[model samples]
Target: MQSAIETARKQLPKIRIELVDCYTGSAAQALIALTAARAVKLGDNLNQIIPKVNKVIPEAEITLVLDTLKYLERGGRAPKIGAWATSLLKIKPVVTNRMGHAHFLGMARSRTQGIERMIRTMRGKIGLNRVSAIIIHSELETEAKELEHRLRSEFNCNETYVTEISAVVAVHLGPGAIGIAFLPS
Candidate 1:
């Protein structure tokens, strides 16, 4: 992406090229890009759009509720001891992107609770009725739709998007992994 942006910059010296790392969250990345697109549509120049995009990128949040820890552990993202403990206790881990990395927030005894906890955390950060959200899942359309419904009902957002997780993301998250990324409006 950086190379592509650099090429565009060379072709259009009048336009500014800015890169916002979404910390590996596709949904969050989408939100950042969306912010830039909106700014462009509003006729904001590179200088104006840069600050807007930068502010939104950090404000963007992604909460992932993993169905299992095996994939994360296999990918060397989870500590062996933590994975073993969660597995033994039948706990589902809820993770969030923080400072360009995934951070463990807490665990839930059930998937339902885990999702609710994630929603609550997002609500605290973004507040209700003032967010735009995207839901992504790996081979979990039903789960993804349910989450989208919750976001619409809870956040009252008109710009909610539902999408399948990309193959690259799927390799690490595995099936049954669901996440939501949102930006406060």
Candidate 2:
């Protein structure tokens, strides 16, 4: 991604191109890009768009519930012993992206509990603003649909997207993973 940005800068030297790193997951990163697109469509220049994008960065939120941690262990993000322990106990981890990395938020004995926790956190942080959300899942369309329905009925969202996790992300999240990414509108 950095290399792509560098190439774009070299190709358009006169136009100021700044790279802002959110250090978050793909969903949050995608939200920042979508925000920039909206700004540009509204005829905002770099100066105007940068701050809007910045505002969304800190407010960006993602809550992930993974059914298994094998991928995380394989990806070297989690210890093998810990992954085995969680699996043995049937503990589901609720992770939130912070500064480009996954941070453990809490644990649930069941997937339903994990999803509930995620929604509560999102509602608390979003306050009264209308939001836009993306539902990402790795072989968990049913769970993602439940999450999407909740987001639409319980929150003020102008747009809600549901997409499968990319292969790169799927490698870390494994199958039966579900998450929500949201930003204020």
Best by lDDT: 2
Error of 1 at 171 (Å): 1.1
Q: TM-scores of all models?
A: 0.87, 0.92
Per-model CA lDDT versus the true structure: 0.84, 0.87
TM-score of 1: 0.87
lDDT per residue for candidate 2 within 121-173, as digits (tens), equals 89898867799899999888887888898899999988899999999999999
The TM-score between candidate 2 and the true structure equals: 0.92
| lDDT per residue as tens, model 1, 1-185 | 88899899999998766776656468888888888899989999888988898777778888988877877888998888877887788888999996487788899888889899888988889764578889988888998898888788777685899999999888888887888888887
**What is the alpha-carbon lDDT of model 2 when measured against the actual structure?**
0.87
Question: Model 2 residue 82 lDDT?
Answer: 75
Top TM-score model: 2
Per-residue error (Å), model 2, residue 183: 0.9
